[model samples]
Target: MNKLTPPTRLTGWGRATASGASVLPVSRGNIADAVVGAPERGALVRGLGRSYGDAAQNAGGLILRLAGLAGDAVLDTVQHTVTVGAGVSIDDLLRVTVPQGYFVPVTPGTRFVTIGGAIASDIHGKNHHGEGSFGNHVRRISLLLADGTTLEISPSQHTELFWATIGGMGLTGAIVDATISMLPIETSRCIVDTTRAHDLEHILTLMEEGDDRYRYSVAWIDLMAKGRHLGRSVLTRGDHATVEQLTGSATSSPRHYDPRVVASVPPVVPVSLINNLSVRAFNEFWFRKAPLYRTDEIHSLAGFFHPLDMVGSWNRIYGPRGFVQYQFLVPFGQEDALRHIVERFAASGAASFLAVLKRFGAGNAAPLSFPAPGWTLALDIPASFSGLGEILHELDHTVLDAGGRHYLAKDSHTTPQAISRGYPRLAEWQDVRNRSDPTGVWRSDLGRRLGLIA
Candidate 1:
C-alpha cells in the first residue's frame, strides 16, 4: 500500500492559502485520464494563482493546476507568436522572447505569473492605454473540457466561449495552450519620464494628457497625503527606447545589460514597517528624490514591467496574516467621487504599501472582464485592520453611487448589492456562463460572494 499526499495550495502574488479537497498533479497521465470525463459538479482551473482575488480558488471542489502538464513552450518569432503550456511563467517568457526582440503583449507588475493565470485574469499592463489588454492580443486558445473534448476558440469562432474564457478565470474550461501576438520593440529599454503631481488634479491632468502617447503608463499614488493635497501622485510614462535615445547613457544596448535582482524576501518584515509614519516618509522620499522632470533612455524590461518580480516572496512583508488587495475603477466623469474615496482612506489612518492608478480605455470584449473606460486604482493593505472591511464596504457604496466598479481580481470585501449595481452586464454574462457551464463545474469564492452565480 502507498501513502497518499494532499494537493498543494495554489498561491500567486498575494500571500494567502487554502486547502484543496484533494491534490493531483496534471502531468501524471493517470490523473489526466481520470479528470477529463468526470462531468464535475465544481471544478476550477488554476495557473499561477496570481489573480489578486479568489478567482482561482475552487473552495471545496477540484482546482486544476495547468502548469504541470507536460509540453514544450514554443515561440514562433516569424508569426510573432508563442504557444506555451498553461504553466509557463512570464519570467521564462522574457528569457526566450527578449533575445528575439519580442515581449508578452501584456504583463502585470510581477513575472512569476503563469500563462493560464494571465489568461484567467485577463491581466492588463502599462500598455493598456494603447493595447487595451492581454486578451485583445490573444489570437486563439485551446481548451480541454470537462468531458474529454477539446476545442480551439477565438474571437470569430466560439466567440461567446472565447469572450467568457478571456476573463473567465478558468471557469469555462482548462486552457492548455494559447497563441498570442507579441509586441516588437527597438530595445528592451523604456524611455522613462516622471512628473510629480502636487495633488490629485495634477495627476489626472497628466494622465489625461499624455497617457495615450506612451505604450506604458502608470501613476503611483501617495495615499497618505491629506488636507487639500490628498491622493497626490507621480506619473511615469514610457515606450520602448530607441537606439538614438540610449546613445548618451551608460549602456548603448539595454538588452545586453543585466538588472540587480532581489533573489529573496526578508525572513520577516513587521506590519509596522508599512505604518503611516513609515509610508509617509517613504512617499516623501519618493516625491523629493524624483526630479521635477527628466527623461531616461536606458531602462530594463524587468525594471519597467516587473520591478517586484526580482524580489521573491515580497508579500511576506505584510506579515503572517496575509494582506488584501483593493482594486476599484471610477468613471471619467466621477473624478470628484474618486477623490472622496482616497480622502476617506486618509482619514481612516490605513497604510497601504502599493497604490497604483491606471486610466482604461473602452472595455474589452469579455463581459465578465473588469476594465472599462475609467480610472482604475489598486491598493494592498495588511489584513489585520479590524475596521478594514467596514471601510471598504462603505467605499463600495461610494464607488457604486459614483457609477464605478471594483476589479474582481483585487476584491474580497465588496457586498452583493454593490456588485449588482457596479456590473450591469452581470446578468447577461451569467446567462452565457450558465449555458456553457451548465453543471456548475466551475465556481470560486469571488463568484459566490459577489452573487455572480447562485
Candidate 2:
C-alpha cells in the first residue's frame, strides 16, 4: 500500500474548526489495506469537505480520499440510473448528465459536493418537499466496512446497514460507489416565479399555500430586517424548463450545461465584509431587486440553485475567523418556534445575507437524516460575532422543544444533548454502526463531539 501523507490541517467549508490528520488516497484495490493499517485513532473517508462542520475531519487519524473506484460513471438510460464512483462530484456529474437529458435526484445549495458526501449527509434541496433526499433515490451502495470487508447493500439487502450508512456520517464505513436514480430534464433552465414577501407571516403563508405547485422552492429572508420587516424575503419557485419553453439561441442548444465561476474572493481578507450596516443595505437592495410578483422567468440551473458557487472561495469574505452555518428543522406544527427564532435573529441584528427557508417533505428511513416534514432555515453568521454561541445555544432549546433538530452537516455550535434530543433514532443507528464497526475503526471529529461513537 502507498504511504499516507504527513499530517495536514483540514477544516470543513465553514472553516470554523481545524484539525490535523494524515491523509491517504485509496482506490477500491487498496482501500481495505488503507483501513487495516489505520492508526490507533482510526480512519474516516473525506470527500469534498463541503460539510460546514467537522463531520469529515478525523483529527489525529487517517483521512482517506476515495479514488479510482470503478472509473467513470456508467449511465444506464434504460433504468434511469447512474452507477458511479463515490468520489464523483455533482458538478462533474451535471456536465455529463445534463447534456444527456438527466439531473441528480437531489442537490443541495452547492454542486461541488461528492456523491459519497451527499449520501453520508443524506443531503436535501429546495425540492425536498416534492422529491425527498438523495438517499431516497439511491438504488445500491458499495461500502467498505471497518474490518476491511466490502459489502453491496441496498434497501432490500442488508437493509439495516443500508439505512445506517445513509446519514451515518461515515462512521458505519467508507462508501466506495453507488447507483442512484436520475431525474430526466429537457433543458438546463428553470421556469421560475418570484414573489417578495413583506414579513415573516406573509412568506410563511405564501410557501404553505403554494409550495406544492412547484418542483423546487426556496425563500431568501433578510434576517437583519426588524419589526414589520422581520423575515422579509424573496421567494423563488420553479421546475426544469421544457425544450418548448426555450426560445431562439436557447432552443438551438437547450441542454448546453456549462457553468462558470464569474468572480472570486481574494485569498487574504483581513476582516469580515459582513456587519449589521452592510447587511442591512444589501438586504434592502436584494429585496427591491425582486419583483413583487413575477412569473415564468427563465433562469439557469446554476443561477437558480447554486448562486454562491458563482463566486469562487466566497467563504473567504467572512475573513480569517470564518463563519458558522446554523441550519435547523422544525416540524409542521412548530411554526410558532420558527417565528420566534426568526424574530430573535432579526432583533439581535445578526448580519446574515444568506438566510433561507424551505419546507421539507416526508423524510426517508435514514436515522440521522436532517430533513423531515417541516420548515427548515439555514443562515451563515460570522464566528467573531459576540455572544453568538450563547444565542445559538438558546435557540437549540427552542428547536428541540418544538421537535426540531439541527443539521449535523451544517452544525458547529449544537451540543451532544441537543443531538440526542433531535434524533430519536440515533441510538438505533449507533447499534447498527457499532455492530459493523465492532472495533470502532471509523471515527471523526463530529462523531466524537456529538457522542455518536462510544
Candidate 3:
C-alpha cells in the first residue's frame, strides 16, 4: 500500500464546507489495505467529487480516490447492459455507447460524475418518473466491506446490504464497480416539446396531464417571479428521436454523439454576479425566450440532458462564498407545500439561477433513497445570502411536515432531527450497515453530520 499524501483541502461541487484530509489514490488491488489501515477517523471513498455536499469527505482521515481503478467500460451490446469500473465517468461511458446506439438509462444533469458516485448518490434525472434513479437500473455492485472482504451484492443477493448501500452515502462500504442496464437509442438526438407556463398552476397542470406521455420531462422554474407569476416556468419534455424522424443531413449520421465545452468560468468571480437583480433578469430572459408552444424540436443529447455541462467550472460563477443546492421532494398530494416553498423563495427574494422541478415515480426499497412518488424541486442559491441558513431550516420544517424529504447528495445544512423525520426507514438501513461493518469502519463527514453513524 502507498503512504497517504499530505493533507489537502477538499470541498464538494458546491464549494461549501471545505475540509482537509490525508488522501490516498488506490486501485482495486490496494483498496482493502488502505481501508483496513486507515487512521482513527476512518476512511471514505471519493470519486469525481460531484456531490454538492460532504458526502465523500473524511476529515483528518484517509480519503480514498478511486480514479485509478477506472478502466474501459465492458458492454454487452445485445443485452443493452454495461459493467464499469468505479471511476468510469458517465461522459466516458456515453462517448463509447452513444456511437453504438445506446445511452445510460438514467443520467443526472452532469456527465462528469463517476459510476461509483452515481450509485452512491443514486442520482435521478428527467426520466426518473418513467424509469427510476440510477439504483433502479443497477444490477449488481462490488462492495468492499470494513473487514476487507469484497462481496458482489444485488437486490436478491445479500438483499440487506445491497439496499443499504444504494443511498447509504457510502457509510456501508466502498463501491468498486457496478453493472447496469442501458437505454437503447436510435439516434443521439431528442425530439422535444417546449411550452411556457404563465404560473405554477399552469405548469403543474400541464405536467400532471402530459408527463405520462413522454419518456422524460422537467421544468426550469423562475423562483424569482412573485405574486401571480410565482413558479412560472418553461417546460421541456421529450424522448430519444427515432431514426425515421431524422431529416436532411441528420439522417446520414443518426448516432453521432459529441459534447463540447464551449467555455469555462475563471477561477475567481465576483460574489455579486448572482444577486437578485441579475438572477431576475436572467430568469425573465429565459422565460420569454421560449416559445409558448413548440414541438418536434431536435436537440442534442447533451443539450437536452446537460446544458450546464457545456461550461466547465460553472459553479465557480457563484464565487468564493460558494453556493448551496437545496433539493427536496414532497409527496404527490403535497402540492400545497411545494407551492408554499416556491412562494417563500419568491417572497424572500432568493436569487436562484437554476430552479428545477420534476415529478418522481415510486421509490425503491433503499431506505435512504431520495426519490418518492412526489413533486421534487431543486434550487441553487448563494451560500453567503443573508438569512440563508434560517430560510433553509424553515423550509426543512415545512418539507418534513408535508412528509417530504431532502436529497442527501445536495444537502449541506439539514439537521439530524430533519433527517430522522424525513427518512423514517433510516434505522432499518443503519441496522443493516452495522451488521456489514460492525466496527463502523466506513465513515464520512456527511454520516457524522447527520448522525447516520456513530
Candidate 4:
C-alpha cells in the first residue's frame, strides 16, 4: 500500500465548499488492501475534483485517488469500444481516440473529468437529447465493493447494482475501470449553426421546433436581460463535420486533434469580478457578437464544446468566496415552472454570466440520475451574494413542487428534504447501497448531508 498523505484541504472545481481528508494514492493492485484498512470515518474515491460540489469529499476519512489506473487504452476498432482504466481522463482519452477517427459517446462541457467521475456522476452533454448520458454508452464496469471484493458488472450482469452505481455519487463503490462504446467520426471538427433568440419563449420555441435535426444543441442565456429581452440567448447547435465539410489546409488532416490551454487566471483574485454591471455588459457583447443566423460554420471540437477549458483556473475569477453552480431540471409539461425561475433570476439581478439551457431527453433507469424529459438550466453565482441562501431555498420549493430535481454533481446548496422530494427512488437506491456497504464503508460528504446512507 502507498503511504497516506497528511490531511489535505480539498475543494471542488467551484472552490466553494471544502474539507480535509487523508489522501492515499491507490492503484488496481493495492485498492483492495486499502479498502480493507480504511479508518472509522470510512473512505471515498476522488477523481480529478471536477464535481463542483462535495460528492468526492470525505471529511476526516480516507480519500483514495487512483494512480496507475490508465495502464493502457485498449481500442477495439471492430467493436467500436475502448476499455480503459477509470483514472484516465476524457482529455487524455480524446487525445488518443480522436486521432483514430472516434469520439466519446458523450462528454460534459469540460474534458478534464476522469472516466470514473463521469460514470459516477452519469454526466450528460449537449447531445443528450439524442445520445443520452455517459452511462448509456458504458458497456461494462469493474467495481470494487466495500467488502474488498472485485466484481465485473454490466447491463445484463449485476443489473441492479450497475444502474445504482451510474449516478450513485461514488457512494456505491470504487469504480476500477470501464469499457465504453465510442462514437465514430469523420473529422475532429464540427459544422455548427448559430441563431440569436429575442426572448425566452422565442428560444424555447425554436429549440422545440428544430432540435431534432441536430445531434448537439445548447443555448447560452443572458440572465441579466429583462422585460422585452428576458432570457435573450445565443443558441448553437451542430454535429461532427464530415471530411467534405473541411476546407483548404483543414481537409488535409481532418482527423488530427490537438487542444491546448491558451491562458490562465491569476491565483490571488480578492473580489469577484462577476457582478451585475459587468455581467450585463458581457452578456450584451456576447449577444451582439454572435451572428444573427449563421449556418454551416466550421469549428474545432475544443472551441465548440469546451471553450472554458482554454482558460485555466477560470473559477478564480469568482474570487475567494467562490461560487455555486445551481442546476435544476423541471420535467416536460412544466414550462411554467421553468419560466417562473427564469423570471426570478432576471428580477433578482443574479449576475450569472454562464447560464445554459438545454432540453433533456428521457432519462434511463439510473435511480439517482439528474436528467429526465425536461428543460434544465445551469448557472453560476457568487456564494457571498446577500440573501443568496434564502433565494435558492425558495426556488427549491418551486422546483420540487413542479416535479423537478437538482443535479447532485453541481450542488453545494439544497437540503436533504429537497433531495428526497426530487428523487423518488432514493430509498430504493439506499437499500441497494446499504446491502453492498453493510458497514457503511463507502461514503462521502454528499451522502451524509443528503442522508443517502443508513
Q: Per-model C-alpha lDDT, please?
A: 0.75, 0.92, 0.91, 0.92
Error of 4 at 48 (Å): 1.0
Worst 10 residues of 4 by lDDT: 66-75
Candidate 3 — which residues are off by over 4 angstroms? 68-71, 270-272
Candidate 4 residue-wise lDDT, 263-306, digit = tens: 99999999999898999899999999999999999999999999
Candidate 2 worst ten-residue window by lDDT: 66-75
TM-score of each: 0.92, 0.98, 0.98, 0.98
1-454: candidate 1 lDDT, tens digit per residue: 1122454565434555444544445652333453553333366666666776677776655665555422366777788888777777777777767766777899889877777778877888787778887889889998766555678999998998888888777777777778888887667777798888888888998999888878789998988889877877878888887666666443555565344566876867655345667777887887778767777645677777788877777777777667789898888999988888888887888887568999998778887677888889898877786699889888888888888888777776677788778878778777877877677666776777788767
- Of the two candidates 3 and 4, the one with more favorable lDDT, higher being better, is 4
- Model 3 Cα RMSD, Å? 1.2
Candidate 4 vs. true structure, TM-score: 0.98
Candidate 4's displacement at residue 325, Å, is 0.4
lDDT of 2 at 416: 90
Give, for candidate 1, the lowest lDDT window spanning 10 residues: 1-10
